[model samples]
Target: MALNIKIHKADNRGKADYGWLKARYSFSFANYFDPLRERFGVLRVLNDDIIDGGGGFDTHPHNNMEIITIPLKGALEHRDSMGNSSVIREGEIQYMSAGIGVQHSERNFSDSEPINLLQLWIFPKTKNTKPLYDQINLEGKRIQNSIQTIVSPEGGKDIIKINQDAWLSLLNSDAGLKHKYELHKPDNGLFVFVIEGETVIGANIARHRDSVEIKGVEEITLTINAPSKLLLIEVPED
Candidate 1:
């Protein structure tokens, strides 16, 4: 099958701005709804949020969704019904499996600095299993100029596990660096989210906060034009 690529510009994403919080939704989230941008396969939600100091989401209920949070700027304090409480900051990733149901609250851990984070929700392969929470620090594990697996179904040394057959990787590349990513599983599609800097995938140019989705491709090459940080998510096409 031929590779099919779709580009989603950063400015095109759904936006919600409150007095204390500003968020950009890659998929349909909350009051921001776009029928064509609802989801890409099993990857449901990808939200880039900037929370003001001492502000955040209050305790909320979630069910049957695998939630993953990655802090980009500052720190976020997380508390859950399962008795899991921790401060997740930059270079760390947090996972929460809201199997049957779970309640949690996320607040800016700092009283003076705002927090920027990416929140993702993926569909689980099986429903109503059990709720779980854990976090991993990716400080020394991430590779420079290459892609590093941060989250996977089969958790291993330095990897966080989720309830779905998916893989989430991070990349930090210098200008002029070139890298190729091979699919970990067949029929899996890849979503590339540019967190910072600029890069070119095939013929498409993606700048900071832009995203590109590739399907039916076994491998994809990335060429960095400027120092860049990116997230690559591989998920089932169906």
Candidate 2:
């Protein structure tokens, strides 16, 4: 089937600089509001943030949302009202289900080193359930030069689970490689974000922080121009 595609350029993202925190948002977030950039399917927020040493977010409240954190550099320390405390580094992924309601705080784990990370918020399939939190490290489990599933609604042995009908995957490919990604649901929407390197999706060349959103397709192809790291997200059209 033919697809409907939208490319979200890296330079077009909303940016914020607070000295200690530097953030680039893929959707409307914080004080950055864009009517045309509210959301894509059920995926709400995608924030690429860099936090200076000792910088952190004070305890904050959230309800009925699924939050995921992926550290790109340094260490991120997480603390929540649910009594969960942990430090996740570059190779780890953290998930929190802010169902019903919850409060949490995140910061650079090191007092002298800065942390760069990506945090995403996805609306749950069902609301008002109990809040939850979980995390995982992809250090030894990563499959080289392939698309590897990291998070999904149906959590598995090596995959983290969230309370949404969504799937998250990581793609690592070498230069001159081509990848074909098949969606789990026919009616679902696929969103691709480039974390490193450059790749061609459809007819567009997407580089660092660029994203392509696709709909009405069962599969899509990606041509990697160089060694690259990418994040793939699939969510229901609802």
Q: Kindly list the per-residue Cα lDDT of model 2 for residues 15-37, writing each as its tens digit.
A: 99999999999999989999999
Candidate 1, 1-238: lDDT as tens digits: 6879989999999999998999999999999999999998899999999999989999999999999999999999999999998999999999999999999999999988999999999999899989999899988777898789988998988888889989999999999989999999888999999999999998999999999999988899999999999999999988
How well does candidate 1 match the true structure, expressed as C-alpha RMSD?
Answer: 0.8
Instruction: Specify the poorest-scoring 10-residue window by lDDT in model 1.
Output: 138-147
List per-prediction Cα lDDT, in the order shown.
0.94, 0.93
